[model samples]
Target: MTGIDFALNHMAAPRLGLADFFALARSLGVSAVEIRNDIAGTAIADGTPPGDVERMADRAGLAIASINALALFDDWTAERAAQAGALIDYAAACGAGGIVLCPRNDAASAAASGDERAAALREALAALKPMLERAGIAGFVEPLGFAGCALRSKRAAVEAIRDVDGAKAFALVHDTFHHHLAGEGELFPEMTGLVHVSGVVDASIGADGLRDAHRVLVDAGDVLDTVGQVRALGAGGYRGPVSFEPFAPEVHRSPDIQAALRDSMAFISGGVARPAA
Candidate 1:
């Protein structure tokens, strides 16, 4: 069997409460999970105490891989700093290893010159470094593949992290969906802290037309080549968490999510073990 370290993102089962969510992960034999701040009426949003989150995770034998994200991270402002600080604090208190940082993905931010955008990213990373260091947590910078995203290139993100000497405080999240959407060829496996996997089997949708609503569990029909991506990352030295992050409403509403996830995990594992043609 291939040594694939599977993890679960809360998005995989958004409707489940923290307790059931943690239980679900454990039931899948997945010991790692990523929680999100954006999910309404959830742990972070519902004001679940960090200690409670920690205790619940402990009870379930799960590691909190990350708190999903700090949005618009590259467009750092005083308010952004505050948000980052709060997230970092919460992540640390909840015994999470890191917090994800998402760059602004809007027209105005994306319209900036490449140089300008890179500079802004560096500046933000520089500002976030010390706070992450103090909190003893890494910041996983997730570059969206959407055209309008300010930071669309992983290479550019790695460069910025190096420019700010923030390597110790930051790592990349190589999302299969975003990597495919971005049409990026390079894979920075050694620098990746997490991997978000999803599938889009809608054969008719073009890259630009794809949205979160279209993402579903990975299967043989996956158009994103998620299995190939996972194989490449594993071959490239990234023995990190490959977390399920399907955002389709149908998946969230699955009556038997456990079975669906189990099948997806088996497919990925079997695919990865097969010899390349």
Candidate 2:
């Protein structure tokens, strides 16, 4: 089988530098790496430009997978537009295939339900499509499963982007853990552009306080079904990275990061997509 492009999220290693990230990825059997600007030890989310992030990726010999799209990119105001434009420019420079657009976090104020927020986000996505197409990039729209996230499923995201001028302008980003949290019991990876694989081994913490910080990788009987979810993505015509995105405190603290990665890869390959018992 062809090796999938497994891009490591920078947040996986907290104290590691750009150089260290590259070395660790190469050593860990990863195919490529994605640099999340917000976690890259600087004020990137405040609108760090593409040139700076691109340079870092180039120096590391890591192909830029996708630039993480965050904040209120869907507000459609002048300020929001400017910020979105800056992020597009940054994605282009990093040689990313696309920029990932996450929908807004729900609020107690005027934001309304996820559906309403998604509507506004759809309009904003339509506006941004032109820019992404102009730059020869696609937009990767990710639906956060947390109660606060407006769009929480690939089905919802696909529907929103369905009527846009550039319908192919973007695709869904699926994370196994998020899918479970949202109770997305099945897999439909045809709409997906990226597959972020991180295991949630901890059975503690109520869902409200849960963050991305506890992600690990696949193993037997994993609650998130990381391996099966990844295999499902492959089955659904997404031949992209099954990237590791551990935001776990332990994964970062472990001294032998390489060994952990190796085991993770082995487990993923040997165990993906077993029929449910």
Candidate 3:
């Protein structure tokens, strides 16, 4: 197997400032990063202008790969449209490569008719395509594997993109944790724009019970098979950044985030040479 390329997601160290976050990414030998607008008191949350973020990343010699996400994207309300426009503007101004679009996840969202959900998805993509193209950014659609998520299948996202003529403006986010939870074996490398990697090591929890809180850095105990998943994506022709997105509070609270990250990188990279049996 070839070497795995890695990128850093700000969720790993939400407490850091913009400059510090970029520096941490550089220190970890990761040249690309994904920042978030959701964390309170942070750069985006604190009203740091888009140009400032671009300048900060430039000074640090880092690439602002993508904005962490635009949530409830599948719902596609007027409010969501407004929010998407604003985020796309910021992404263009900040020189970020793209925007992550997360599907609506709730019991109500899951209960909607399949046809209704498909129609909404098509409408949203058709509406979002021009904005993304004008801004020169790709929309990275992430399908959550949880039962309550409105969009749970990459195949479904691809089909919707085709229906809306969004093949060029949108791509899929093949998230390892979600893939495991979804029990999906397919890897759509051609349509994948990014890959999110995380691990769940709790031996007692079943896939149905898994939640974002269970996500932690990949390690020896990882039950989600992060190594094999990454290898498969790479072998299947994916060459994008494998960004870390550990939602577990413990990872954020780590006293030495850099060290912990280094360890995970080593573990993941080592797996390339010893492909899982």
Which candidate ranks first by lDDT, i.e. highest?
Answer: 1
What ranking of all candidate models by TM-score puts the best one first?
1, 3, 2
Best by TM-score: 1
lDDT of each: 0.93, 0.72, 0.92
Give per-residue CA lDDT, model 2, range 52-112, as digits (tens): 6667666766777776665656667888788778778777776887777876665731347
For candidate 3, the per-residue lDDT at 63 reads 89
For candidate 1, lDDT tens digit of each residue in 89-135?
Answer: 99999999999999998888868998889888988999999999999
Q: On residues 1-277, what C-alpha lDDT tens digit does candidate 3 reach at each position?
A: 4766689999999999878899999999988999999989888878999999999999988888899889998788899999999999999999999999999888788889999888888888999999999999999999999988888889999999998889999999999999999888888999999999999999899999999999999999999998898888888888889999999999999999999999999999998668569
- List the candidate 2 regions with Cα displacement exceeding 4 Å: 40-60, 109-111, 204-209, 273-277
Q: Where is the poorest 10-residue window by lDDT in model 3?
A: 268-277
lDDT score for residue 182 of model 3 = 89
Model 2: how far is 224 from its true place, Å? 0.8
Number of the candidate with higher TM-score, 1 or 3: 1
lDDT of candidate 3 at residue 223, scale 0 to 100: 96
> What's model 2's overall lDDT?
0.72
